[model samples]
Target: MSMIFSWRRRRAGRGRAGKDEFPDMELSIPTHFRCPISLDLMKDPVTMCTGITYDRGSIEKWINAGNNTCPVTNQVLRSFDQIPNHAIRKMIQDWCVENKSYGIERIPTPRIPITPCDVSEICSRIEAAAQRQDAKKCLDLLKKMKNLAKESERNKRCIVQNGAGCALAACFELFASFSIEEYTDFLKEILSALTWTFPLGDKGKSKLGSAISLRCIALFLKGDDLSSRKHAVLVLKELISEDQDFVNSLMEIEGIVEALFQIVKVPICPTATKASLVVLYRMTLSENSEMITLKFVDMGLIPCILEILVDGDKSICEKALGILDSISSRDQGREGMYENALTMPLLIKKILRVSDMATRFVVSILWKLCMGENENAVVEAMQLGAFEKLLVVLQVGCGERTKSKVTELLKLMNLYKDELDCFASSARFKFLKRPN
Candidate 1:
């Protein structure tokens, strides 16, 4: 109906022709052909040797306007030397008139409906059912409300921003706290629904999924309920073990690891770095330690770990070192593992350039890490020429307390033990000996 009015308007405009002449305008089509670009019967048909036919007039106009390519693949098309035959033009026009919606552009999707559910009302009913101590009634109501919400969403009529909030409230109303069995049931359902929200090819969706999953995992790990924690672990294991690229790609997401790191990085957080360190610790425990090592190594996990260490997030820094310890311990006889130490020189140089006190402190822990079979690492440090720089930092020149700490570290390594006896004859040592 709208199309009929639009066509009439277009005809009226064409009748009021310009003072200058215009090219003959006609729609055309080759029999049994359609434009892949427009997904419509072809008009102003231009033939290719490959037997592909196109609408030349539209193609030319698009090219002159600087498009210069097929509408589908953007492949360049040569000039249209042969105009389409009149018979073809008539066929396309007849078809367009018969199917008035042909060649019509599609409208964009409507916005998601913002019909907010009355959270309090839902909560009241759930609470009332729970007060009656009717477990079945409470569960049934939860299931019913969830289904209703889903239906409303499918119909584009409701917005429930936090699904977990609703589920949590319902669980609280029922038991004042849910049991592991009950909590697991709710989490499994919520996670399943949440997973469905991911859109194909959406980087934002990928990030959102990872974030929500992380949050759920954190809450589960924190909750005293054993079943919830077990379920959370199960979910995390599934996520980490997924062969699908979509989920695994979350590792490449920026701030993802950092976000998880921040929570576990704090020394004050109970079980701080516990869950995270356990994850790293377990990876090295796999029967195929080499596979996990190589995988993390490729993801630049070592650099990230080193960065965390340099951040002086003490627990996480120590945790990362522990992870390194476990992996390196396994690679003792393995030729492939020693090469990882090669990164130490680069890490040391970067640490030396940083001005943070916490960073230097954490980096100093390298003394502890590099204690045994670290001749290669010591050589690398020396090659980077950090020993003299470190010794200089150890003297009275560095920050007063930090200098003491540095000197202590140097002593721990026996770095200047031989030189100290030789230093007794030096002019600087004599001057120091005479000083107050």
Candidate 2:
């Protein structure tokens, strides 16, 4: 019941406010059609406990302005609750319709505010369906709940306060042990609803039992349906991002980490790829689990990550660089870095072509490889045209930190003129002189 009414002029048999049409005639509004407070047509008319009816917006403004008295009667209000004057509202709509030639549009039906009782009743039905293993009934109720929550933030809070989160979690657990082949479609609908309601920061995610969630969601990631797997990863991403305990306990869940790697490695979709990459990045960064880091390199993720860095989306490239930088800082990870023949050339190509943060990461990965306290490392980079890229950056402007790295890398590799002469002899751009 919160529609704004304003006068518009008629032009070309259409309702539009224009210079010539508005002055064609001055239409008068009935006094009863106007709010005593604002003199505007009452869109959402309501009666105060003082028996005075006013437009809801006007009365709310007057009350909010610190006057507890009725604007018309000037009598003190014992209670401030405003009851909707539906009869008056219908009259207003009828009048607007009857005045269609005057260009007044019909007001839309106002949505009744969802109460806590509504949330509780829905939650109860969902919980009962879960207990009975009625997948169809549970899906219907959860879909309704998700729709109601999407109506407004107030509805979302009411749903959570009335136990929607816990109810969804319980349903997830009840359906956990079932095979995907048997309950694939039902599980997809259920997980979608769970993910929808999961971001409320309610204690339900934790109270729903982490072990149960981790196991069930991990299994969902292996399902045949693509959307369910994607939704499962996203839900896991949001759920685990806040809890460090879950990050450490990840190793305990057999295949949870593998599922994430699979999704990141061969994602069913771009969203899934990005979400999985982000989750992996956050988990590895949050906890410096050396075992996890080594396992990442051991699984041949470095090569896969290098491919992603070469061809992924701009946002995904930045995240892939961040992940590679983290994992490549170790001895084993360093080995994995140069093990892929395309790594250095791809890294060189991206030097100045990406965002500043990505450029910095590319340089960091190179530094880790070249400065692994080995002379061959620098020579390897020089052979791959990294030397020329470094010289170009030195000639042009670059960040101070990146320039320092380039200078240090050059200093460590600086050697006899004959080393350059020898390198120049075999260079593809043999006539291309190095920048002074």
Candidate 3:
């Protein structure tokens, strides 16, 4: 984001004042002389995957805005990355030099972008420092790697290949052997680095999946440092997303589930809370492990999930609802949810509140509850106005599975037709509308 501002100032003045300050050349400049995206003379021009050229700032902004298609081509981009168009940039610079009498400022040459080799060199240095037990040097290298990775997706892959995970694991092992008081801050720095470079690939995951790294990862879950805790959960979330085997490994750690439960309950960072829920959902993907479900209930995860369901952000809501759908498939989880007062209404509210993904989970949870022994969950659904919403959802539209779940709940609700006589025929639920 700061890059956008820096490019703007380097172009001329702030905002549209550059034009007013130098009005002589606006008409003389050919349309092709301007960036199609920014409508200003090219500065640091770069070509994108769509084979379209744009000023670096404008194309970057477009990608940052979550648009991965070319504005001109309207073609799906092969990659979101920008390649610097050095030839086009030279033409722009030469034109500016030719138009100096018209007050056009020749755009300065952009700094040479760091290459994969540069990141690899830094990693080599970090590894050398590690072999010598040079903690300061290794820490400095890790900081530089973090900055390089953050600069571009291309750099992230380069850093990963350079053994970032192995480097971080070495840092953890080094800190573990040191007197705790002396290396606590470096340990935090290493965890912070892990947080920033999450979702590492096979090479990195092989290193992070080691027993030492798992134990070290769990330590942050128990510590007092809020940032470290957030990093731990987010890193775990990324790991779980990539590999269910990693999720199984996490389940073996003594206090991992409890620690995750604690994170959801304590809620230091919103992202951490979402991440912990995401991890739980991922772990639940394993085969029918009744003990895991029982353990989740024992850690008091049900209320925490439901509480977060009420107030969590989109991703958090999606994950919390997903876990609820999974856990409610078991007897103990269903019993725990039934006991919580907010669980039903909030689950009902979540139907159309967050996303279709969440709506699917919500409907599935209701279906699980309704499928359980008799009308307790059904009666509760009626009390929460779920039947009306379900009917409306069925009437308008939803995914096939979601529609199936809604249909099942409606069938069960109709079984108690005598009890629902007043409720179903009444005008109370008539105002309900389907979600878009």
Candidate 4:
């Protein structure tokens, strides 16, 4: 009887294996093998406090999204501790091995997840090193943290959530008060680490927005290290506040504007260029916009902006145009624009070429250049087929303000119509039809 029973069990096992070999056979996976959150086969099964098992990656994503309850049971979790369900993982691996003929692959063992406790310990060590002014120790710890952040998004979130941002910010504030030559490496490391914690909390932003912090960043901007310069500008972009007083305070930093303009004149990267443009734009938002605009003009900002408008991507072009429009509000700014040979043609080309925002900016800039007793600007517009583009702007539709500006521009160009007849008759303007 025993021998017969053993034979029957072997027959049943073989029968299942034979069925699994068929291509069309539907393999019914065990229900417990699938994660509740993702409904996929568990690669790294972990049991939560609620006794429900889920794939580690899936549950961590759910927790990272700010959910505190078990996804399946909807029960509020008392603790986030996830224990590895080694038994289920082993079983899943065994099932995969048995179904290898069906193309199932075994799940590899998952690495240990970085808990908040691990991040907190590292942050504490960093803070201690900063307090003691141990530059070497601080550098090593920061590099360690940087490597961890690079490992995975989960690690980055863990580092930031565990107060690494504030720790690094405090380090910056402390070291920035000292001479730049004394702690160059440490400051660079701090800036690099702080950048990884972007979209920082309010506390970190406040700490970095201080005068000392800004001064340190300005010094880095003047440094020869390309990576540090890029990091400095990126960090500065995040620290810009809406307060007019705060915005004006940036001007007081010696050589700050010139440093940013240097980055624009000779871009280190597209990101740095955009960031410098953003900082310059925010500076113009203050009450002293005229003085600031004149300063920018003196620094040859007009030509740089025109060059960017010629070939920059859409976002960069929009930002560059915004700066140009602000600069054009003054006489010196208009003079600077006229001095650039590409100014009129480039602005006209961008009229309907880029985004709606770009078109509005171009129109505003043209209006500024042509508004005063500048018949030269009007003639230039007419000769360049600005009349046709303006008409198209009206026909294609635009904002009410843009429509008003285009109407005014058309009326101005009409005054020069007789003189522009030959120019308008050119093949370039052949497609143009005057609006009634």
Structural similarity to truth (TM-score) of each candidate: 0.30, 0.66, 0.75, 0.77
- Give one digit per residue, the lDDT tens place, for model 2 in 1-436: 2334456664564464543445544466677777888888888788999888898778877887899898788889999888888888888889879887777778755566577788888888987887887888988887888788787665676676677767787777677655545776776777777665654354566744467667767777876667889988877766776565666665577777788889877778888888888778866675565677888988878888888877777888898998888877777778877678877878888877777778888888888887787666677677777777777777876788888888887776676335966767888577789999
Worst 10 residues of 2 by lDDT: 17-26
For model 1 the TM-score comes to 0.30
Backbone clash pairs for candidate 4 read: none
The regions of model 1 sitting more than 4 angstroms off are 1-105, 108-117, 123-184, 190-275, 278-361, 367-436
User: What order do candidates take by lDDT, descending?
Assistant: 4, 3, 2, 1
Better candidate number, 2 or 3, judged by TM-score: 3
Off by over 4 Å in 3: 1-33, 45-109, 149-182, 422-436
Please provide the root mean square deviation of candidate 1 (C-alpha atoms, Å). Answer: 20.3
Global fold similarity of model 3 (TM-score): 0.75
Candidate 4: tens digits of C-alpha lDDT, residues 1-436:
0111011112234535552222254466787998888878899899999999999889999998999999999999999999999999999999889977666788887767677898888878977987887878888888888888877677788888888888788778877776567998889889987776765566776777788888888889988999999999888776673233556778888888899999999999999999999989887777788888899999888888888887899989999999988888888889998887898899888988989999999999899999877998888877788999999999999999999999999998998897667665686677889899
Q: What are the clash counts of all predictions, listed in order? A: 2, 0, 0, 0
Predicted candidate 1 versus true structure: per-residue lDDT over 1-436, tens digit per residue: 0112122113224556655443444434334546554545554565543334565545555555786555665556575243444455566566656545334332222223222355445545656766675566656655655665565343222223423244333434234234435555544444433333222123323332354445545565455554444444434434444323423343444443443444343332434344455455455555556656666555555655555555544455455655665555444312233455545654455444445443354344445344445555555555555556577555425566556555554554456434543654574566565546
| C-alpha lDDT values of all predictions | 0.47, 0.76, 0.77, 0.84
lDDT of 2 at 224: 66
| Top-scoring candidate (TM-score) | 4
Please tell me which predicted candidate would have the highest lDDT against the true structure: 4
Estimate the lDDT of model 2. Answer: 0.76
